[model samples]
Target: MRTADSAAEFQTAAQWQSWLSQGSTFPVFQPVLSLETQTVFGYECFGRLDLSENVASLGTFFRASDQTLNTLQQEVGFTLAQQVAQFFSPVKDARLIVNELPSHLTALTPLELPSTLEALQQAKFPLNRVVLDVLLEPGFQNPLRLKTVMERCHSLGCQVALGNLGSENSQLDLIPYLKPDFIKISLTLFHRSFRDRQFRRTLEQLGRLAENSGSALLIEGIETAEELQQALQLGARYVQGYYFSAPGRLPAPLPDFQKKLREALENFRMIRTKRIQRQVTWENEMLLRLVDISFVLFEADGLLRLNETDLEGLSGFIHRLYFSDLNGFQISGDYLLSETGCQIDYRDVGRNLSLRPYFFDHVYKLHGRPGGWSLSDVYCDENSRCLMRTFSRYVTPQAILYLDVLWANFADL
Candidate 1:
């Protein structure tokens, strides 16, 4: 065995082919556990090589073999199957997940199986127990070829899984057409796209797609408790990553695996519940504070006639204020707060508010109750382009005060 100074030391494609042909490559299994059953759903097979000291990473090894990717991948697949057949023979329930490139599928002759499939068959392993995890790569020439391969694999009692989903190489738009039995979402996407609304929407859409197509969603690369919770919340049926266990020999039943999973879930729930309670409490307190201020204004004038000046003295979170009559007719102008000063807009004045849900449900319905006030759920305001909540209260016999509170103030709660 010769040690290379760096990955670039394997300069030529021949060097890579020579390294792969030396038969030093072997498979390591990573358990994909079922969240529902707390048991091993399957083991994903990753290829490891007996390389010289300075190889850097397996990724570098694969990159050097780009020119002969198909050949190297086929060799790896066969080796992995043989290893699985030997060591993982007694595991009847757990599936074997083997990765293959899309282009390799195109090279297969009709009605003929790949070397890995043949090897598995020779070992007397049921085809259904093997999942061909397709690694989406660039330069995929033919969709028809890939589809044919998938159909043939299915006919042979094998299952297909689309791996590295949400990664740059993954063609998400082709998911519907591929219709894999499983979709493996990469962990990197969660780190990058968690806070992004569009990406979250895409994730939600993928979840729905998996559900509708009868495909199980597997969230891969989960390496932390938070990541595990996120995967569970996103409805992943199977999860795999170092958070559970690193890739190694066949894992025995982890006695405390279920305990740790349940603890993480409980912690997540507690934190979420506390946050919601805090938000609700904050909203209630703010509304009550506004009610107190309204009473002060009423006592000062002996009549509740709120103007721009009156609203200016209030909290900055109050965006707009107006009053409605008992019959749900607007009686006051819209007093709006601005960066410079408060402004009164009369555009919507004299408009009927009777049909408004808040008017009938809050004011008219709960009019006579003591300290009667209704705070609406957070909603986007079209004019301000900000989240807001409307607080409505009966200030006087003839008037109902409507206060628009900026939801941004309590957004983080």
Candidate 2:
């Protein structure tokens, strides 16, 4: 509970020396609960200073102090499993989650058990009962070293987690390679993203990233019912916070049968159903509009022949409309809609688009399945930096038509 402002009291020369000595710290276990079952999935271990009322986290202090205390920090975590191993003897599926920092990984030998983990095992705690919450900062580390260390953890039968997802220190680039069993997003980062207009968009991306990595989302620091709901909405299966129980529980407690979980889950399901309904309606309306656009293009005879009058009822959401050949080469000018109204742009008339998945995949996929259109995943156009999706269909015998729609086109959820 000690604040960093008062940390000066512990920064004295003698206190710093005391920090290097043993018995200065011990482990506190915070429960990570599964919202679906409302049960304890695991308990994340923290290194807390063995001080009286104003006790502080050793992990927090060492991290902020830029000290070489990774070894001591990890010792506290392993002690949690050792000291509390008897508690989980009844809970066959319970795990003791621990931090394995970047420095720890770098110091480790390839495919070798970390010294603390080795000690934890000697205490009879199963490696499978350990979830190593790993981290990577924005700065680059030796990729080969990380790979070896990660493989070592996995090979030893431990579940590895990538922590700090969505935070400033989050290294999203390393996620695919690390292939963590869980992607841990802190509560602070998740709440900060709520204020962004693109929060939903970013959430979808995070979901996809977790999906592609075959990882479950583990969101922590959940302190309230609303926060739990938000974490659930973010697709987090495992969550931790004071709302369930604070850290330092000598023997981690059992599931307390929280009514809050049931209520949040029911609300989550209801809200999700309504959101899904809205998406279905949006898709149907947008598909109809695309068909109407195809009809307009047919009625106009050609791209250049189309004018502002041609976009009469469809200029609202359409960013641009163009025709491309089967091989994905644009054959016509764009009927682009602007704030000033629709205008024709011939700049990209002969542009090659064979490599563009939006164009080529649409044409190829719809080869036999005619009379239908394809809607692409929302993406940011690097040129304009606008969120866009391509709706493509064959409007002419020799060319396929594409309508670029802004992401704001009713995917409000």
Off by over 4 Å in 2: 1-15, 19-24, 62-92, 110-112, 186-188, 254-258, 289-308, 338-340, 354-357, 409-413
Poorest lDDT segment (10 consecutive residues) of candidate 2: 297-306
lDDT of each residue in 1-413, candidate 2, tens digit only: 44222344564444544653533555667878887788778878776655454565555444443445445445555555565565544556778887766766776666456655876777777887888887655565676687788787888789988887776756777778878898887555688756765764576578679988898888777888888888888788878888888886454555663576788899999989998898778878888766655344443334433445767667677888887777777777878887677777788867887766576568667879867888876777765778788888776677777888888655464
Clashes per candidate (backbone, < 3 Å): 0, 0
lDDT of 2 at 300: 39
Candidate with maximal lDDT = 1
- Each model's lDDT: 0.73, 0.71
Tell me how far the alpha carbon of residue 117 in candidate 2 is from the true structure, in angstroms, after superposition. Answer: 1.3
Q: What tens digits encode model 1's per-residue C-alpha lDDT throughout 1-413?
A: 23332445676667767766554666677888888787788888766665644222244564333555556656666766887788777876898887777766777888768778888898888888889998777556677888899999999899999877888767776678878999987666766656764465467668888988788899888888878887776778888888878777664555666786778668767877998899879877786677557333332223234545555566566788888777877877787886678777877777787765455667544646835778776666666777777888777667788888887777667
- State residue 108's C-alpha deviation in candidate 2, in Å: 2.7
